[model samples]
Target: GAGVSQTPSNKVTEKGKYVELRCDPISGHTALYWYRQSLGQGPEFLIYFQGTGAADDSGLPNDRFFAVRPEGSVSTLKIQRTERGDSAVYLCASSLSGLLADTQYFGPGTRLTVL
Candidate 1:
């Protein structure tokens, strides 16, 4: 895909269940990010990966939320022991090298509903 692509446009899961959101970044993009957006709020950074290692993950709310980019092209956000508060739109973004001048391309987020 020319742009970032996320899997499962919407997800409905019961409270306490686990969920995984996938993202496929554009070809040649070495930087990938995961974010979460609640209702009436802007996206909040959750994690950022440069290549296969996490460059920054200070935005993650808690220990339950984790993201990984094993191959540096595909990334996944994993939520363990989900709660109702965890419901939000999971956004994925990618850039050339995570440089200051790089432009981030975002994917259509996956809306997660916890009930």
Candidate 2:
């Protein structure tokens, strides 16, 4: 793949509902990251993956938020009992490696709305 791709560009759901956001990263990239951006705020790192394991998941708010990269290429973020505050744009990025300074290219974010 040339770049990251995210599905369901826009999502709407009730506050208690669950949602799954998908991301397909660039081919051969060894690192993938997930971020959540609230209105007027910069993206906050939610999780990072190197290969098939989650390298860092400290940014996830709580048990309600979970993510997985089963095969090191495609990843899914699952949200349980979504709240109104969870409404934001979910962004996915990938790089040749997950270095702090490496250029991280992003995909068009999936805008989530919790009513």
Candidate 3:
């Protein structure tokens, strides 16, 4: 009955570098999502997966960002060419379905700091 969890809670990276942030979803949940939250802003959906396929990825900003959920349970967000603007809380959430109204339980997030 573990809830969604993210590692490293904080990360500091140099510009133009690459980073990977991980997420572990709740048991038995087949839906997982990744979102980025900037200061004082709402979480912007990045990608969502149902089972092993990415059901929605339109929210990803550009090619520099990517995510995967190979096992349908744990997910990882990868960023290439890190920029100062990419510094934010990378949150992970999970729900029972990919439906619009499903309540997503979020993790504390890995705060990526770009220097």
Candidate 4:
């Protein structure tokens, strides 16, 4: 019954540091997504997980970004060698299905600041 939720509402880290951002999708949702939003722009898709496997991860910027949804409910986004450019509001969303047309419920997002 709970909506999507992201932990560590704000994160501050230096460049080259590794950070892990957590997300809890809605109960029983089969689809989960991760996005990054920069200033003056809409949220950019990063990855999509259906059940326990990643269905699409083409939106990930580079090898530095990775995400996993083990057991199909909780997910964690891992960033390695963080850079100032990686600073953004990391968003998580979930839908009933992994359909493009399905409405997604979004979380508040975790604001990451890379110094």
lDDT of every model, 2 decimals: 0.94, 0.95, 0.93, 0.96
RMSD of model 4 against the true structure: 0.7
What tens digits encode model 1's per-residue C-alpha lDDT throughout 27-98? 999999898999999999999999999999999999999888887789999999999999999999999999
Candidate 4 lDDT over residue span 8-114, tens digit each = 89999999999999999999899999999999999999999999999999999999999998899999999999999999999999999988799989999999999
Candidate 2, 78: how far from true, in Å?
A: 0.3
The Cα error of candidate 4 at residue 62, in Å, is 0.4
Which is the winner by lDDT between candidate 1 and candidate 2? 2
Positional deviation of 53 in candidate 4, in angstroms?
0.6
TM-score of each: 0.97, 0.96, 0.96, 0.98
Model 3: residues with Cα > 4 Å off, grouped in runs:
none
Alpha carbon lDDT at 25, candidate 2 = 92
Error of 3 at 104 (Å): 0.9
Model 3 per-residue lDDT tens digits across residues 1-115: 6788999799999999999999999887789999999999999999999999999999999999999988788999999999999999999999987688998999889999999
Residue 3 accuracy (lDDT) in model 3:
83
RMSD list, candidates in order: 0.9, 1.0, 0.9, 0.7
Per-model clash counts, in order, read: 0, 0, 0, 0
Poorly placed runs, candidate 2 (over 4 Å): none
Q: How accurate is candidate 2 locally (lDDT)?
A: 0.95
User: Looking at model 1, which ten-residue stretch has the lowest summed lDDT?
Assistant: 1-10
